[model samples]
Target: MSKVRGTNTLPEMRVRRALHSMDYRFRLHRPDLPGKPDIVLQKHRVCIFVHGCFWHSHPGCVRATTPESNGEFWAKKLAGNVERDRRSALELAEMGWRVCVIWECETRYTDALVLAVNRCMKHSGPISL
Candidate 1:
């Protein structure tokens, strides 16, 4: 829909805020990047994508439920999103950039989101739940 936004979304903002609070600096949606990642830490060579569960079709996510109306269209659209995501991530990885995909559901827990950012930054130590 026209109301749908592709950037600065609530989930993306949540991740950005958490990372900023952790003293991490990042760039927002660099067009040069494969996917114009939500957060790009050039120093750390990491790219973060804050994907909506419904939009990106997050596996096993309740929010990913398909719409009853226009079933075929929604399925096709969602599937394309997933495919493009995978291709973009692969391309970024091949280009030597560490890619991190944080689903909308994961953004609900700031602590976990922070941990995921840290992990993507390659900080040492176990990633406990």
Candidate 2:
């Protein structure tokens, strides 16, 4: 599925639009950050990751369907993705940066996406989990 994107995803673009409309300035994909978060508000010490439901293995999400073929391969692949996400998030947190993970499903719901971003803008915490 090379056609599948790993950057500039649809949900990521939407989040960027919302943040821009709110006058929240941020860096796109800061390489210095763990996992190279989608949007990085350096001034606020906050980073946001717009994760795909299928790629990040969003729990309880219908979009995260396991392939009927190559069952074991898909399972291991998704599991690794999730594990990597956890590790990178932990690393960012331990380094004193606030992290916000916005899943594709959440972004699909306007209210949820808005709420999460607004909270990120206003939150003074280290991480939103």
Kindly list the per-residue Cα lDDT of model 1 for residues 40-105, writing each as its tens digit: 999888999999999999899899999999999999999999999999999999999999888888
RMSD of each: 2.3, 4.0
Q: List the residue pairs that clash in candidate 2.
A: none
Candidate 2, which ten residues in sequence have the lowest lDDT sum?
120-129
1-129 per-residue lDDT for model 2 (tens digits)? 889888898999989887887778999988878888889989898989998988888888999988999999999999999999999899999999888888888777677777778777774542222
Q: Using Cα atoms with residue i matched to residue i, what is each candidate's TM-score against the true structure? A: 0.91, 0.89
Clashing pairs in 1: none
Candidate 2 residue-pair clash tally: 0
In candidate 2, position 13 carries an lDDT of 91
